[model samples]
Target: MGVHGHAVGVDFGTSTSLVAARAGRLPVEVVPLGRTTRSFPSIAGFRGEQLLVGEDTDDLSGDAVIRSAKRAITQNLETLSVAGRRIPADEVITALLAEIGRRAEAVDQPLSMARDLRLGCPAMWDGAQRQRLLGLAEKAGFPIDETTLVDEPIAAGIAWVMNRSLFYGERLEGRLLVFDMGGGTLDIAVLDVLSDGPGTEPEISVLSALGAELAGDKLDQAIAGDLTSDLAAQGHSSSSARRPELFTALVLRAARDAKIALSQRAEHRIMLPSRQLGQLPMLTYTREKLEEAFRPQMDIAEALVWAALRASRLTVRDNRSAADLRVLTPEALRGDVDYVLLAGGMSRIPYVERRLGALFPGAQVFDNAGVQPDEAIVAGLADTISYRRLNLHRPGFDFIIEWEEGGQLRQEILYPAHTPFYSPQQVLSGQSDLGFARHDRDFPGPRSGSGRLRVRSTSGEYLGLAVDNQTMDGLVVRFGNRMDFKLYCDGRILIRDGSGRALHMRVDRWPVIRGRDSGRLQLRSAVDREPIVPTGWYMDKEYAPPIR
Candidate 1:
């Protein structure tokens, strides 16, 4: 697919946010949202009645800035009044995204001209959470859709292939593990390179996917905890019991800066400007000390990586997909896996890279020059749009699609559990016959509608964006098999089964939502009893609706 025009991609991260775009024939370009930075801090606060985001936010004794809102949103922090109105990560994230959109529009070349927008998200977000993210993007001003909500690791994987596949395409005969460690989450995906044809490219089959709440922010907290204890040991007059908020706010920023510095330098000194201790001396932190503090977090990260691989039923040798299997070590393979692509801000840390390399020593690791950890997801998303359209989404479940083939009724699949969907242009040669469904342009009616608002409930039958009142794309929703409800995606309305080889097409269902933490859009079934509900908002579901 020859990318002909402009398309925007946004990576709304835990610590920061990025907006990128790909113009015709150009590389993915990061849209600078700050005066001197391409990455924008994902924090928002209120100054009186006005909302402020990014560079303008200040720590007004912890009341002014909302930090780690993404985690709160994902975990469904019920005491959202925990962070005030932006509580649970809703309003603050939307505000942050709106700010990003403003920045993109200000660029001289006019990125505003881009018609479609793609947003990257954690792979672990389930149906409700994904629905919530789409809702937030609408509140933030980006017109997104169900299909546009792509997995972050998959986007990073595409970006990896874009850079390395030109020469290494054929050599990537085996699978490549995508290990993404960002500010707030760790995501891993095992992709099997489709090499069944003579001229196959980097099209991949996502074997298994998994994510963890652990990430760089946790490392920063670990470091801060260590520093706080050491400072208290030095007989500094500290009472977190008295002012816990202030203490953490002060320590977290200082600790994060120290970590970033320690990445490029051997040592860093942190100043604890405190009144309790009456101006303490500077604390010197070496990379070794930082790594030591990160030990526990790294251990969890390593475990999650191997766990994800194990989920794929992949090991050093072939075996029955039936019998149990074990994860292989670098020594076990000796040399089989081709590459291990690392993305996210934490990957810049030498200790992280070292640990990852030790786990997969047989493969080459690329960090994309360390210039754009926050930008990779969005950049790759843009590349997917402008370069070749491919959706690396893993199907949620196996659907029994009933279609007619040789004048006889048959049952097959719209998509398999581990297979990926690709545009006709992006499909590799032999892989082309796989017959994966696409959601591009098959609808004949209105493309979208005023979104069906999901208020307090177990959850919707199927969580997908609505295209008009009649048609919708069916999201393979996760729910108990016995329950019943409607499923929708873009333009396709779904019942319990379908023809195996279906093509997806619907451009009008671009997702747009009027989200608000307080808006009550209650939906119930024609049947009795509600089955699904939000455990919590994922990606900060609803803090405030757009000012539409």
Candidate 2:
């Protein structure tokens, strides 16, 4: 899809970005950038009239640079100031993507660059954020139709599946918990893998998924806060805190390095490299001090894991603690977990690995060998054509409708947030299709505009409405009426009579779509981007035949 060649995986991180590409029968390789390195810092800046990315941001040493474009986009900021004038966040992110594309195409073999891209996103980002990011990438010049956005943790899990040595050759089975604590987000995925006989690849199924904003970047911020107090204790910086840019750069760099260093050694020293403030005294941090600063962060991480496990219907024992992470009792290891694939640089921390390991009694915890944690995600994302086709987009909003059936009233999930819909069900061995929920069946015509449906927010706030198109008012339901029910993938509900006519609602055009059928097939972001074709509209091979 590119003018020259093709690129498969693009791991857009908060603190860095990586790209991987492959040609026919070629091994997947990370594109070299920034002094022949595979990963580049995700820093962008506007110098003069030009936008700068990758190694170019090194010139912004004393100046203010757009630190985290990913975070800004996640917060839905319209524009960010580069130097002085405000530039749109979309333009900034696009610049980064464009730079990556250019670098990827400049490989030794000179990749022509395919238009199709596999973008890795945080598991917690909902449809709104996902759409907004996709729009930004499209504006940056990639083909939107060919691009496939996937959850970061799932990508890591796939990477683990591709390379199973991390399991210590124990023949991994049961629930494989993937805890990805990266620079900007913490994602948790529980997968069920089953092997079939000898030499055949296993099947991976998603059991449940959860994520939070808590991650390594948050720990850096917490460490930076602690540094401010340390400065107060030093008695030198208690006065000269004027140069904010210098302070911000110095603190962040020190925090990141100190966090990594403290993971292995008991003590680490941080030196302030601020030219404006001149050379300052080196700050020494012991493991005890680091633990003190990281306690709150670890508590938050524990809570996220707790919630993710509960969502997956897994229970934990009472002795789950990082400070006292010992061997799990035989009872504790019962039916809980088998292995945990720990991804991201943050997951390498002794506290994180041990703490997460404590939650799963008999599970083996694996992490980056050396500097490979940051490089692992992009490779998994670039494994093959299969990675690009894997789409497990669960709904974000909870939809429930009150209906009368068999002379009694009942309410259940018309569309559950955790249930993925209408994909190539043949890809999986055993899974239900959405065919039952959507069908044109033989039945009698409707008696009236009588179905009563109330849509509400997850917190019980009334937001969705069942409109009657007849008089342009709320729908009124009459008992014993036959109607067709459709739960759209984009969280829309439609009800029609046996004659295939919509009823029980009256309304003008919905937010960013046209016509009923078109609206049901389109998904809109929270920030309102250009409308895109819905994934649920059925692509080629929308159903896959399970391999026997």
Candidate 3:
């Protein structure tokens, strides 16, 4: 399917935000949200009920200004105090999004005409987080639903493929790794790309996606902390010691600007004015100093890359060892990756490019000439909408619920892979209930005691579940009586007993199970199924009886 009309993509970063649009068959263009730049700060402030966002917040100061509102969302903060008024974080984010929409409209690129809209998010975000952002987007007047959400790293891969096809007249087909280092998080994804002939859009399937809260923001804080120490050494700690919050914000912003400058130069100057200490002497921040502050985070990023590779089963380590160790030796893995795509503002660091190149020796590292690190995600998102790309796919592995019965371990296939989980009808009704089953028929008779109930993948890797806001690999519940298990289309698992005691958790991560025919799983449409029966017993209708 081709784009029916205009399509818009929004990449709401922690420190900044960007919007891109594609009209009919035209190329994707980044919509300028600022006066002179294509992107603007992801910030909001209030001056006595007068709201300000993006570039408007540039001259604002004090607690009224909220910086990194996206980070606040990640930390699950419900409300933020702005100008003596407590405002919901979602509303703050909605204002920023709405501002972007207004700016796009002012430039004759209104989102109202967009037939498709895609919002990019962190790959590791839970269902609740995605839903939160979707709701915010909807409130901001961009037509959106669950389907509108796209993982940021996966979007980067889509951008690479689209760039290769549209400009270079080449189709990208092979294992692609996306290293997206943004302001607040570093997201790594391994994808399998395949093109079907000349004019057709490429099919991209995500093999594994992982993320860590290690990126530009942390790097900025590290640099700022080092600068603070230097200032204290020079007898200039009055203002910072008094108005620490305000002082910290100023330094972090300076550090962030210096970090960007150091990307293209050998050194950057950091200067700050203080009413308490008067004007302080300017300090030179060298590239070496920036790299020194970035080393620890870079180490974490390398480990995260290896972790994503292991999750995708692209490495040579045994499955058991790969699953057990958090980090693996890079020497143990072969250079099977075809291309390494870099995205996000932090990816502009020369050290980052060199490090990734050394890590993936045989793979082609995309340089800035071929890709714009900061614009890739938004561009890719717009391309996904323009080309009607089919990248979102069903789970490649089955979900297993395990528990002990009669002194023996028993397991049931809670949700099977490649099955119809969602449909347009379900979306219209705003219901995602996939299946439900009674515990008596789905599990073996339990002994008269509390037993451990675990949820795992088909490969026996325990999946994390958040029960009542607490994440756990397994849950302990009394299992002598009748219980109910309900599975939702959004990876939510709900378990309830006859006594009305209920426990629920959303499965955020699934173990990758490679197919026998190929190492990659084919992309499947998310809305290809019919409206599933809400009360249907999935275990009885699909799989055999529980295994002991």
Candidate 4:
């Protein structure tokens, strides 16, 4: 195959995209298209009946180009218009993935035969959206079975940890926070990087994490609005413009450029045509004024960082006695944060680092050394995949138990993330309320019975959250005689309910894990079952099951 056996890491970012993997001793190179870097602008353009994707699509026409496709996932979108032509998001994604495969195959000859991939997406994607993306991947000839979906924050975290040397430290320790300001989203995560243990692989654990959809584009729009206002003051309006979309597009583009310039310079200038601004004027913007306009967006981002910290179990300190909690708890540490990491392209903003540094002066914050702040996520993706591959060859990390409290009985999750690919299937056991069944049409499904069980991963290394934190922490309840659901870090599940007590199952028997000697076991046995499943908020159950 190609270098290191063909596995690829796909960073499907909101603003830009990239694919990388371990090629050899040297780091994985970005799959380039002739002269560009590893990243491709995340955009798609439609012309007549054909679709143009990535960088070339970005150049087609601002009106035709669709940037930040990931943001559209959370919206209600059936079709997108490009030059009055309607196209589905799936079609756009299919075009992009096909282009990704084409460019990758051009560089790695082994990848020519390899259709399998490890794709990364935003953590905010829900169940339906994730399935839609998977469907798109399959329609483009890359099947879901051949791919593994990782969240962007998780992949970024992995990349950050692997490239730890770049941060200048004697192997990191204590709670570190990652303030990832990317194109379409802002994610904050808290981690505890432990010293290399005598018997374990150097471990990093997530203590807390959270994210907001607001990102660079929002700031761009904010500044663009300010710029537009200035132009309007000079008499530019949609009624007078030849093409309002074109004018708005130019203003937005200029806003993005100005934002980037402010990351380095104290002041910058923006030029506009006299015709666009009532014939008497050219427009100029200083970096200070732009930052002033964008301050609201930055405030939201800062709040999200502190909110993530408050969401952690670490925040639940023992209210009574200090001896009741672990010595390493934040309270024990006198509310001190130990480490702070910076990932994603937008993180390079000088103000971001400066503000975060002021918040936790005792903690160390990491920023990559490169001209393009945006390339770090993809580069980190490459480094993460490589390091995980290496760990697969060494002694793996230990697993911890996941326990949830119930009013009566406790529920438990026996397995956690990062369990080696070759590890045997793990098991979970818990007792549920064997209560009465009512013939109720109000049930979300046709099933007759319901039982809810809460489970959490106790794995030391999760994809998105810091090490030691469970990204897949939630409840799995089956009702109408049967209950089933698949859990994930993305917080999306495929559930099914059937006849009774246990509505539907992958296998017909208990102790259901089958060996290779048995006929192929049911894939859906783990979670997938029925359709028309209702999506809603599930309360985190924290009950401990009583010992029988």
Candidate 5:
């Protein structure tokens, strides 16, 4: 299997990246990037003209290595400095993607011939970030397009639902809350799943998604800071302080390892190398200490969950404003949620599960059995490619365009939720006269020469395109000027005036259907006769014990 005709799914994570592939109806396989492990570090190192990535960067010095390059996309940073060289953030990301491609091809020769490649990203990434990643993937030689991106939590949900149906013979429906806390971010999504008659695929709709940049890495820093303070109190010489950056890096790595170890045991020994920390004594980091360090971030994470639930519009016994809403004790949601699926590496912590279990007392909460939390996203991403091949995917949100007219809000539905993004008749095209003269007798527009337009989802979340007169007067002009509006399958909206001037805005979100559903067209009779047992790494893993 050269992956010549396979569907590849990539989870371009904050700390590590994973690649999975499915060929025809074959089981999805996680492509190994390291000698023994599947994970590839999301870091890059520069030495003169030579570039190193992932595990290869492990030996590089702090000044020469770029870690968490993914954060650059979120911060909108244009360049990163490495080894006294300034490099474009896009180039660094592209290099990482390119390396992944190379490794996948190494495992399966000519993986470059893969028919499709899909990437998983955070749900909260705006349009610009998504587009930037898409561009970088293309630069890396992946056959990616606008529809290649899938929200991480959505991917995790898909994996959980598919795993349940295929292995346990259980059909999960109703509302689901996906709590994904990875190395760099915490993303929470509330989705509604509806099943039709037996054997028919369930309809999945994302009610709301929210995220914050608070996760594993932040906790690691807190632990490191605590260790540094402890060392200072012991009268350890500050000689290592001269190379503060190097010393901090070593401590942080030790802290991260200790955190992971604490997940499995009550305590972990964190021993920094003498070369890195001088003659410091071995440190024993306890789970209690880790919990204390994580408390503040955990508090923020709990509040974020509440915010996401409220935004989902799910039924609650008492709906209160943010000011009055109880942060952690969201008893109102206990009866509303049917299941809580934990995902991301950070979710493996016992404390996280306990917290979620306590919050959703009436609901079943658990991680996908046999599936590693970090790999869930990639598995779901690969399964999505398989679903699309069978025409069993649908859009998750309704696309809408809005404007102001006669002091009232005017809007039009460009694409309704669950519609196929590639449907010929559904694709937005052509020009429509705004009839500015009819609405405003004082034609030729305002002296400022601008107007406002917004593109958003039915959930009331804006999708990044908000053109106001202050920015562009010629496009949203008055005086009955005709304009063309075209929405591409990739979430790109292009507007053109009669004068041929054009304005482009990307929807800042992916159009791929998140949950599960048949395409706009009816499913094939064969699909209805036999349920598709999605094959993936999850199939062989033992189920996790249920959390009641």
Candidate 6:
């Protein structure tokens, strides 16, 4: 059987967002709230039951809407409960996602094909947050079975790899790092590109991902604040205290504009309408002045780059160590990092390119006027969805494991995580004596006995992770059975069943188990009930009228 139809790619950004699609035809860009493919201000406002988003939300009033909610998604350690209803991070994301969906298919055909959507998620998302994103996508009209989470940096890296032929005649060699500088976050990912032959998709291996929310928007705000303070100190004050708010907003807008202009020119002029100022003149911003004003933010950017380099499997070093050689030798790791694709609007600044060039000398940087840095994430993701629909690559493997007594793990399947959705007669190998244990609440220690197979149903119906210790003399194992047991492990995603292929896996001593802490497991009389739905504010689901 073959698959027909195109998939959609969604770039749900912090300060801006976009959606792109190519359904069995050339890709057509989709813009939100206007004809522009990329929409901004990322702020949403409410005026007596009228919901306003994007540019219109910039209008400041007491009934002004939410701003920079994406930043709060990771921080803002407070729960907002209004009228006995709780609002959560996922709920906000879902609202944004639904808005994007509405815009993408707003014109003609129903976006039913977008059931197979690819979403760009941040690299800094932890396991719990990742799951929450998955749940949110499912709730926002995207089917869980069809949606695939693509890391923003990874998608950008893939875009670079795919377009490598256009830039270079030879296949790409050496490690390439994708430094994604966006409005709200900076993500750096190290990708090891494997030669997949001519016209074949490159097999990408992500060595590491490190990111921080300190991006262009933060820098702009800092610069704006500095300018506001300096102007106020110069005896410039509004008769009304509320005028400062309007003045500050204008400063921020001018700061961002000047930041972009300074990308090509050394100086730019910022016009103050003279509404708030008592006859103060307009402000002219120079590149040198802006850079000086945002030095602290630049320092943070440098720190984030160093942190990303340190997190990689390999690092640029003068000498190689024995352990390092076993993983990725310094000799193999050392090379010129190529094509630092500027994907986000933040990278539009000239200083960013100059700083990146100074940081990694000898690497060529290219920026095209047509490649919308703000919209590249969605474009690349949309292209990736198109590639997948073409069956460009196959899914990987998964490892299904079972817990036994004595802090031991047993392989329940030959392959996992990458397994096919449903496959029958798939046999696996496991051992009973393999020490796996359910901690006893009362006794609090390892028990010396064999344990039965454990399986649990995921939020996904008809999907399960089953591990049996009682099959085929504990050697031959078969999957696709219904058995309920509590299987605990260090990582959440231990299985990826891709097709009938058995993923490579091995049972070994558990990493967290120690000799002294061995007795911490105690069997309780009552079993905990399975969660029908996720708990906490992060999983709160709410619906608001679609953005008009």
Pick by lDDT: which candidate is best? 3
Clashes of each: 25, 20, 0, 34, 4, 36
| Residue pairs clashing, model 3 | none
Q: Per lDDT, what order, best first?
A: 3, 5, 2, 1, 4, 6
lDDT of 1 by residue, 1-548 (tens): 34466777888889888887777646677878777787888877667777677778754445456766677656755324332453445766667767777887888423334566777878777655766777877776666543466688878877766655442333345777888999888888776664443324445656556787888888988888878877777765347335655566677778999999999999999886556324676888889999999898888777666556544542222432211323255255434456788888888899888998888877887777223655678777776431232423333333333333456654333333323322112211212122234332321112222112122112222333333333333333221212112222212222211211112222221122223321321222222332233232331345431110
| lDDT (10s digit) by residue, model 3, range 322-408 | 224334456764365899998999999999999999899899988542447998998877874323444333353444555666678
Q: What lDDT would each prediction earn against the true structure? A: 0.58, 0.58, 0.68, 0.52, 0.65, 0.50
Worst 10 residues of 6 by lDDT: 423-432
Worst-scoring 10-residue span by lDDT in model 5: 427-436
Cα displacement (Å) at residue 398, model 5: 12
Question: Higher-TM-score candidate among 2 and 3?
Answer: 3
| lDDT agreement of model 1 with the native | 0.58
TM-score of each: 0.68, 0.67, 0.72, 0.67, 0.71, 0.65
Q: Residues 334-416, candidate 4, lDDT per residue (tens digit)?
A: 25576666777777677777777877777766675221345555555554333332211101111122223344443333222
Candidate 4's error at 532, in angstroms? 36
For lDDT, candidate 2 versus 5, the one ahead is 5
> Could you give candidate 5's per-residue lDDT for residues 1-548 as a string of tens digits?
11225677899988899898766544568889876788888889877778888888777776678878888886789998766678888888998989888988888823467666678888767655776887888788887654577788888887776666544557667888999999888988777676553344556666656677889889999998888887778775345465666676677778889889999999998777777556778888899999999989888888777766654542121333232432324676466689999999999898899888888888888787337888888887877332432211233444443455678765555445433222111111211111001112222233323354433433345443223213321225322344444443223345443333445543323334322231221111111222333233333346521111
Evaluate residue 402 in candidate 6 and report its C-alpha lDDT on the 0 to 100 scale. 44
Ten residues in a row with the worst lDDT in model 3? 517-526
Model 2 / residue 228 / CA error / Å: 1.5
